[model samples]
Target chain A: MTVAAQSEVQVDNAEVRVTEWRLPPGAATGPHRHGMDYVIVPVADGEMTIVAPDGARAKAQLKTGKSYFRKAGVEHDVLNETATEIVFLEVELKV
Target chain B: MTVAAQSEVQVDNAEVRVTEWRLPPGAATGPHRHGMDYVIVPVADGEMTIVAPDGARAKAQLKTGKSYFRKAGVEHDVLNETATEIVFLEVELKV
Candidate 1:
């Protein structure tokens, strides 16, 4: 099977934005929502726990070298449930 | 004082994906474009140089905690112009 790749086009007028997350062991990011559409990429792997807005809690093992996208509007808090430091990247389209 | 925040909505059927990059000093990831829309977040800072498809090269100091958005169709190559290790995150909505 062939792997899909990144897109190629001339996009305009969009500003660049980035966010860094440094989570300590068992620390939570608190409750938050995606104000703008953003992408999440993990540069480091840490056991993560995500709590949905409706109080649904989920835990999963996140690894580096993968990508995930959260919509422009979603409520959740991500916690680095591991004993080691967790780092990730969040990119957003600045309006 | 007011700061715009992340959005909140119940999105469906989108998958989570991630990719990692480990580049040596003066190393390059080759020429490629974004196949899907994605966000870029810098979790770590290093001197980065980006080259657009039209032979346009831009060098900027990328720090952790800033976000940027590249459309689904843009071809660019990013490099760490510094001697230090650089790390970042990319998130994309999987169709």
Candidate 2:
């Protein structure tokens, strides 16, 4: 069994829900789907392994302080394959 | 005269807009209003000086990797009063 990443809800309000996710080496977020539009802000430069529902896998390179936005209905399992810990903040829009 | 902070638009889509703001010492974002609900992810531990329209000033403490959300229609000028530069990612949700 793979170790799951740790997530903490930093803020939840009418506007948005912000969650901080910390992934140790070899940790994964497991398969999940996003219910709302979201933005991701990486805390450091790292790479993430994205596994799609159809078993397709891809590598995503994240830059520190860089943010990206995505629409709703994204399904994937994010894994940290690096030796260093990876941290990021996910902001979900509550519209 | 206060130096203006540098802003780079990272992403813009139907759901959200992501911008990275960099503030050097004594720099400010100038007076601006947020039209959409937003979240801010700090790049490092620092303090920001928020100046309201009426000249009221307040200090906002920011922790690295921590994110906070706010509603729309907020008006303020954000400044970096520390010696080191401060950086953050702002995600605006277009509802």
Clash tally, candidates in order: 37, 0
Which sections of candidate 2 miss by over 4 Å? Answer: none
Each model's C-alpha lDDT?
Answer: 0.60, 0.89
Candidate 1 C-alpha lDDT tens digits along B38-75: 65555567666788888788887756545566568878
The segments of candidate 1 whose C-alpha lies over 4 angstroms from its true place after superposition are A1-14, B1-95
Across B49-95, the per-residue lDDT of candidate 2 in tens digits comes to 99999999999898899888787899998999899888888888887
* Model 1: reference contacts kept, as a fraction: 0.25
Q: Kindly give the stretch of ten consecutive residues in candidate 1 chain A with the minimal lDDT sum.
A: A1-10
Candidate 2 colliding pairs? none
Q: lDDT by residue for model 2 over A1-95, one digit each (tens)?
A: 68789999999988788999989999999999999888889998889999999999999998888887788899999999988888888888887
Candidate 1: residue B30 lDDT (0-100): 68
Residue-wise lDDT of candidate 1 within A1-95, one digit each (tens)? 21121222222245435556667776777788888766555657777788998989898676664556656888898776668777666555454
